[model samples]
Target: MGNGYLRFAALGDSTTVGLGDPLPGGGWRGWARLLVESLQASYDVSFCNVALSGATAAVVREQQLDQALAHRPDLASLLVGVNDTLRSTWDPDRLHADLDHVAGALVDGGATLLTVRWHDHAALLGLPRVLVRPMAERITRVNEVYDDLHATYGGLRLDLALMPEVTDRTCWSIDRFHPSELGHRALARAWAERLCAAGLDFPLPSLEAGGGREPSWRRDVAWMVTEGAPWFGRRARDLGPWAVRRALAAAR
Candidate 1:
């Protein structure tokens, strides 16, 4: 609670950057923004969202962490590592170390850190059979690191893997990774409920989906061509060789 108001910082990757939930005029609005809005009813809040698209754990540690810490947030959320799993550079030890640094810094600074256990993104994305196991293994490792951090830091955590809504196609955009507007609304509601349950003096945000335009097939197709394809190409270039090497070692 610096500057006479509660400060909230959000850090991670595209999801936190609000890529799936487009604003009507232009920009993006995600669950974190919704959560901050909810908090404003009871308390003045200063919110900073430093998450970028396609960022890895190392990226958050090196680039976003300092920005977040500067806000001196009363609460902060960290959700990342899916992009790391997509790259050839994926390393569990390095991922853990980066996360540890980010989490430790926030908690040490007296911020209540929020973490998440990721879902099986490979299954959700319906990735190629050859890539599924490798991706799943990496996601599992990421979740394990989150579990350790939650235990060590004694903060709130959301288990997306166990959330049945996460499996529903309606919760996801066309890409099946980022959540749709309704999905983001639900996530914000859930976080508010958790904070209230943890004895934070704030009312829960409504679970209703509002102010969101329904997604259309035409728009979805356009996004697939313009955004999705290029993103997939970039990931494939890096992830392909690593997957091949893993497959060869398995065959041996």
Candidate 2:
């Protein structure tokens, strides 16, 4: 049915990069890979994951969009903007414009565009109390942009807020940012369900969470000390003052 060969290209940030779901031999085998495997039973699926770590929406447009489009994919998933919300330079209009351009191109090129409405990541991260409201507002605006894009282009949009497992600690990796192996499998299963409902003739991916390394408390602490702390420090430098200013303005 259809083309018999499905070209699926993933464009976004680290989550799409599969950071939380590492392969045994190395590298990441995220939701995109799992979804592709499910499609294998019904069609020849060609997958390209061009998502980068810490990529903003603008970054995706400028960098990854061309790479994804070059593959001439029949299915495209754009799951970015959380990085944008974290930065002081976040601009919803610009986010909308960048996403619009990417979504428009995908739709016009005959690809089934996929988007995401992110959840309350700030709450989950337990960011500083000062930043909670502002970050939530930013995520809301970002979701609004996705809403506009979905209204215009008409595609599958996954809303992470509805996923009960999103708030579960087990669903998150050590970084507490990216999804764990179980989380990635859940996401892949969700996508498979959506695709099947949309008439994709593919077997559903197994919901069983296996094949990834188990989490270790020692590894978690090590990563937090090495990777997480530095990342938080960098973001605090930028987002801290911004949050303070927003708070002050709100008080006024």
Candidate 3:
């Protein structure tokens, strides 16, 4: 799509790029891509994915935001701040400014904002002591800022948190960081529901439409008891191409 052709332009990190579980394009197919297609079909719209790998909120603003702005989308979605916590790089001031820039730019382009937060679903239940505290803190801080920012920016909608089960467990396969095919679908569905609530109102690209029933991810997550899995000890990094590619293919 050309500049302005896309009604939505998504920004942020791996989640933005769909680094959940690689499908076919060296990138994964997750909620971000699903949201784009669903919005297009449900609203008769188009979108651009300007998501990059390893994007922190600061980097996203300084780098990707301008490129996304060039699309002049009718809507903009962002799920940043994960990396900030991962790298211990949280900066409330810069985050606020960049967030304003993103929202303001979207408004100028006649689009709305879709604000989101991502915390590893695994940070609940029996998560290790070290991991739980920091992760919880990050989620709290990020959500707080996100809520405040969206409140100030009228057309913005605060989407829900990540899929608890899929994220919290080893649903991703061996690496256990990004979402697996199943995990990606769960994420996509959750996102679709939020958009539907925001008035997608129809089922063109929604899971409620012709798409297969609740991809395995959502189903598996729903039933998981968190009783039989290894806990996350270290922070996560990016994934390999095979994984990313698998995710993209699934999305297509």
Candidate 4:
């Protein structure tokens, strides 16, 4: 694997699509790109990212996973489940089953799989105590599935939930949900380190550097109006009704 060119495919949602890490030409250069670049320094690497913003794990399994599998990558990364956590009708058992199917399919097809456990963003975002507890619990359940899957399969797991740096304000974009460019770079470095530790031959670099510049207040305000408000409105419209229904069901 080391001697030949590596084909890499990234799957999942907004994090994999790189929503917060804007590029000069309009698209994003997320952790996937960073990782490929790093690998290209030493080996020939072809990369594909089939992640869509606002995609759920089920959507990834139904839509993106097939496209990724078609690429027949030597390595693949799956970063999902956060969107599922926010859903009102989230079923952990179903999520786990879907995850297992995806992981098994990828590994069975001969790709080295990589996945992540989400950080405790509910707490970091300063949600109300009521909201935070439930959100945290949901995230915990999702991560437990991640742990189990990683244990059963020999995939690399980036335990971002345990990494304190992910919660830092500097690592988040204006939306406060997605990782900033710096955060993405940090994530890429972490992945590289894990791969190297697992015996992939590559030059190890310092992970502390390469933080991207912080956005200015003016840009922040513009984003709030243009991106943030619309995002919030959309979520409310889409998830609000489902949430109400779930609450009613619980009460019954």
Indicate which candidate wins on TM-score. Answer: 2
Model 2 lDDT on a 0 to 1 scale: 0.89
For candidate 4, write residues 1-252 as lDDT tens digits: 446588898998888887667776567777787787788877788888999988887988999889999988889898899888877768999999999999888898889889988778688777545456667888999999889888888778888967766767777788788888777777888899998888776654434434334456787779789988897777567656765665567679
Off by over 4 Å in 1: 1-4
Number of colliding residue pairs in each model:
0, 0, 20, 0
152: Cα error in model 2, Å: 0.4
lDDT of each: 0.87, 0.89, 0.59, 0.80
lDDT by residue (1-252, candidate 1, tens digit) is 444378899999998998778877768888998888888988889899999998999999999999999999889999999999998877899999999999999999889988899888888888787799989999999999999999899788899877878978887899998998877877888888888887666666666766555567898889989999899889888888888888899999
Model 2 lDDT per residue over 101-199, tens place: 989987887789888899988889988889988899999999999999999999897999999889888888877899988889889989999998998
Structure candidate 2, residue pairs in collision: none
Error of 3 at 168 (Å): 6.6
Give the candidates in order of lDDT, highest first: 2, 1, 4, 3
Best by lDDT: 2
Supply the global lDDT for candidate 3.
Answer: 0.59
Error of 3 at 8 (Å): 1.0
TM-score of 4: 0.88
Best-to-worst ranking by TM-score: 2, 1, 4, 3
